[model samples]
Target chain A: MNRTWALYKKEVRSYFVSPLFYVVAAVFLSLCGFFFYSDLNFFLQFGFGMDIIGNFFQLLFADMSRAMLITVPLLTMRLFAEERKLGTIELLFTYPLREREVYAGKFCAAATVFLVMLGATLLYPIHLYTVQPYAFTVVAAGYCGLLLLGLMFIGVGLFVSSLTDSQVVAGVGSVGLLFLLWSASWNEASGSDRVMGVVKAFSTFEHFSNFSKGLIDSTDVLYFVFVVVFFTNLTLRSLESRRWRGRR
Target chain B: MIEVRNLRKQFGSTVAVNDVSFRVQTGEIIGLLGPNGSGKTTIMRILTGFFPPTAGTAWVGGLSVEADSIAVRRLIGYLPESVVLYPDIPVARYLRFCGEVKDLTGNKLRERIEAVIEAVGLGEVRHREIGKLSKGYRQRVGLAQALIAEPALLILDEPTVGLDPSQVIEIRNLIRNLRGQSTILLSTHILHEVSLACDRVIIIHRGDIIAEDTAEGLNRRVQGVFQTLVRVDGPLPEVVGALRSLPGVDEVIEDAVPSDAATRLRIVSREGEPVRKAIARAIVDRGWSLIEVSPIQLTLEDLFVRLVRQQPSGH
Candidate 1:
């Protein structure tokens, strides 16, 4: 565990020192800011009687969730791919570390970056708080939902990164996979409720929606947790498989 | 403290490391000499517990590589052929991270980072970003990381592959200075390097141990006969005939050119024969000035070629 954390800290410090992290953070924050302003203007023009904070929560969850599908890949693409390309994987394997330590360290580092980016989006809510002193529970729940959704995206990104030694391939492949999962619910509408139900069960967004509406369903929480654990386990197995292949 | 028995590794039908075996004792520097694709890196990987051998067992620091890899890893430090580092990281930070992975922390970790930096001559660049440093400095950083843990065994594969001549000498001197502190298993095809840095040399050819012994011992094993080159200011036939009639002289070959004031003759003799003195006496007997008489010793390159040729073709 100590070794794992040491690797985690090194990875995180590396991200901060490189330009890649800043580039991704800049692009993500700009997208979130644009959505916040556009959603606010649209609601004001429509003059809806619904709560403004509630409307912003909807926009934040929906658009930022899609934004994550784009940026999460950028964040996790270098996790294992860069190490393999630079031949540093051999050095890491030579250390007194298990495959689990490396996987957990990189996973936590990427997830922490995602969490920090999500935290930056809290300014939109603070703006709402200034306008109206409303209950904070729903907003908190919505942020929690975004966090869980981001974790799942990170997991998928890490798994994709492990499949190849090219960061471009890992990033593009992760985006494609996340897009397919996002659009999965549309496949079940044409007289296939049973198939649609299974698809929805696997769709990460479906589980996320319940929390965005201020509902923390146990099933939804378990679903996100399961996805995170499942993908991390797959990443670990992929690393172990490489040892059998013996190329390194 | 390392032992291997019948180690074999294959990817599909392509064998990378065949049935190979050797031993390394404590405080000994062993060089794994081989040409490209001779399974040098594959064997080192197995020793470092990076991969399990397909059909054999390797023990390092009294721990089996297959059974107690974690313990084995704790006992060994490996430097791969290419040095790869986090380009964005500072030198000190990177060394600290290596120390941490080696299970050092707090004051011990800090001390190791400082000591390794000084040991590798990286004190000037300790705070510099690794990406901006030159290749030589980067290699120093890699060496520092390997030594930060101070393990009992050090496995370096081509540590000076891409360095300039002076840089190579610098790294060689560093390894020489580390002779008594740790056991080293270095792999390289640079024959002169083995002669200079290693105490014992193991030559592997086509995935098998072709020769293993001290540098002089291996040279003597393949050096069954000796050849002497003599230059004399006398008639070529007289010099050649006189040397040939000597007791230990096996054969004598004289060059046709006598135009340069000195005639050249090569005399072959059985091993352990002192043919130089005999050639000098022959030249003096003929009242000719002997310009030079020297035994032509087989260099490491010649020894390597002879060893490889002695191996069966299927190997």
Candidate 2:
């Protein structure tokens, strides 16, 4: 059997058997559903018969993006941190598997759960589509971007969770780090072009906004890919640090 | 199947295992006997390829532990010192996961889980969550996971640490049952565990191997000055005096209770001297009753203590 897939199955089983994942998913969907209802009411009041993916779902997308964004880390805090706290990380690493297999198995499993939560929100777009026709390409692109965003968040979560054994600390630490990445564009300076270019490059919002504009720029897609790989590789390194750290 | 050469590990400035060297042959149950924090676990961790040693090398089944760690792990099944398992996971589920990671699949995986469950005596609580189990059962679960795959080498760290007397015997018997199937290296501070379960004992203290030999060999090593126990159904002073006058007997002390009919005395004799026959003859000739005559074998507890304490300070 593929060790990575076996580990992935084990982790996914653990996630679903415990109510923690179910509770988090329920809370996330309820919050997203609430926002979707209110925003649809407001959209129907103003625009009666027109619905386009970009223009119609833009405002609600922004609202739910934050919710979906926050859900990723909350789901991942226990991936490595709780294992360490339970001392299962020692058991895990001692298995006949590579560190990358463990890291990839865990990262992909968390991404799968995040994908399920993001998939459950498809009802909102279905409701909007009921009113009028819209550009499905834009919705597809938007989901693509959302997945990339979730994967990037999961990567950060794995990295943060690997850094500490406390679930609380991993949760808070990843949130703090994600906040910095999200807010990079918020304080965009009008001082100099060089400064503005640097902030735009680091800002997750800048690249994510292109998906809402129905634009799948290769550069933007590559940006999310790079960030995901960077943090996931960092997580792999963290798992491998026992070679130098001596103990897990 | 296991070899460690000058293995050293340092957590910060404190040395956990220092220049320890040993070998375990195929089909041998070697006991790494050491007290807490004496590098017993450190050596097992190295052999299991959990972490690299600071300044040494180890090989499992002829594979270099550092260079071929994943391969080394593939050949070894390890039970850590702390049996920290998933509390939310059921015993069978946990064993299944362990089996899966060990690359067991399909019906083979199922069979192995069942086999380990039966071997560790976990059938009664296979469906119970690990956290709900008693400590003894949890230890059994830990053992089950380690035994799920039946790898070539099994390394257990304190396999019977906190079990009740019966559970301890059960786990010991489980390990004993795996005698020829797997080369086992189990670490424990329990002297009786070493005596009963292991064929050879390696006494470790302060990150070094203080003694390594068979149990009987260790007893003989400590028998330079031998001792025997003799019970006589006769006068206490006369029995003690008669044994004291025998040649090759260094000293005799009464070890009998005042209420007992038979008087027991300890005869201290130099090693390699057959004083028991002479003492028996003298007792029989004096018209005294020689109820029992036996050599006092050195207990493992005493042997472990002597080996651990014989070292100089600051070594």
Candidate 3:
């Protein structure tokens, strides 16, 4: 377990040093910060001493989660893809660690980096608090929702990364899937019964809307948990399949 | 320290390792000799639990590799072919990560890293990123990572691959110095490496194990004849007759045509059974003078060539 922790630290360190993390984090945060600043002018009309947490989260969380849907893949893409490309996957699998342990290490690493990236945006909320104190409970719930969504996205990205040696393929492929899932929840896009079925099973944006409003529905929680578990299990299988498949 | 029985590995339709079997005793240095695509790497992978054998079993430190893959991995240090490494990581950091996975921590891990760096002569480039290092230094990094655990079994696939002659010698001496502390099974196409470093050899060719024995033993088996060239100043037929009648003589091969007053005869004696003393005495006993007699010894290269060139059973 300590080695697993060590492996997790190593993976996180690898990400911290990689340009991909900085590029994604900087781009995502600056874009979000610009939008958040623009929204702040309009939000101040609600007046002082009012608990604007409800309205504050409703306006910002949707775009933040959508932004994360695209950028999380960039952070997770190199987790296993680069290892496979360099043939260091052989070194990893042949270690005393189990397949699931390796999977957990990578997943936790991407989650840690994602958490840190998301944590930087806490400045926007803190800026709102300095002006006038607001109800902290809804803001906390909204953050929990973003964390859940971010973790699920990381899991999906990690799974996609496991299937390819090309980081480009992994990043593009996971981004494509997550964006498709987010778009499927649109009102007019679900016109077809087939699209409705997809929306029912995998629509991440629809489940996240309730969390942005600070209502932690069990169904929404379960959906995020299910997606995380499903993709993580798939990644574990992908790791095991290497031993069955020929060559590195 | 290592035992493989009837191991077979197939990459789809192509069989890479076909029912191969060999063992490495504790403190023994064994060479897995073969050319490219000869299943040497496959066997090492299977032994290291990198992948399961399509069919067969292997034991490392008395634990089944398939059944106790994790435990087996803990007992061994493996250097894969090409020694694929993360280019971005510095040498010390890479070894520290390797040491960590084996449950080493704190001062113990630091000291082990220092020890392996010293052992593999990687102290100079320990702080450099692996990608920036040259081939020989990269090799030392690889070797250092493998040696970090001081494992009971060290499975190396082409340990000296792509290194210059001097680097090869340095890597070899590094391995040679760990003789009694760890058992090693290294694969190499270089024949002299086997002769100089390995106590025993298991030769594989085309996915099949062709021969397994000590270097000298394989040499004797392949030769099966200890040849000695004899030059005598007497009748050719008479000399041949006398030499053929000597003890342990397999047959008499005429080396070349008779020159002037002397004739050359190559005496084929049973392998590893010396007939030189008898041949010398017999030549001098008679009035015929003994001009020359020298035994031709076969090298590991010759044995390797002979073994691979020969056909496999039921092939």
DockQ (CA atoms), all models: 0.71, 0.73, 0.64
Q: Tell me how many clashing residue pairs each candidate has.
A: 0, 0, 0
Error of 1 at B14 (Å): 1.2
Better of 2 and 3 by TM-score: 2
**Which candidate leads the pack in DockQ?**
2
lDDT of 2 by residue, B1-315 (tens): 988899999988999988899998999999999889899988888888888899988888999999998888988888998678999889998898898888999999999999989888899999999999999899888888888888899999999887889988888888899999999999999887787888899999989998899876787786666778888878888878888888899989878777867888888888534798888899999998889888776888888888767788775
lDDT of 3 by residue, B224-291 (tens): 66778788888888889888898898889877764445688777787443698898888889888998
Error of 2 at A20 (Å): 1.3
lDDT per residue (tens digit) for residues A161-196 in model 2? 999999989988998899889877786565477987
lDDT of 2: 0.86
Predictions in order: lDDT: 0.87, 0.86, 0.85
Q: What TM-score quantifies how close candidate 1 is to the native fold?
A: 0.89
Error of 3 at A242 (Å): 1.2
* Model 3: docking quality category: medium
TM-score of chain A of each: 0.95, 0.94, 0.91
Give model 2's docking category.
medium
Looking at candidate 1, what is the lDDT of residue B303? Answer: 96
Tens digits of per-residue lDDT for model 1, A33-128 = 988888877877774667755575677678888888899899999999998888899899989999999988998998888888999999877877
Q: Give Cα distance to truth, residue B147, candidate 2, Å.
A: 0.8
Give the alpha carbon lDDT tens digit for every residue of B119-196 in model 1: 889999999999899888898898899899898999999999999888888899889989898999999988878988
* Structure candidate 2, residue pairs in collision: none
Error of 3 at B182 (Å): 1.2
Best by lDDT: 1
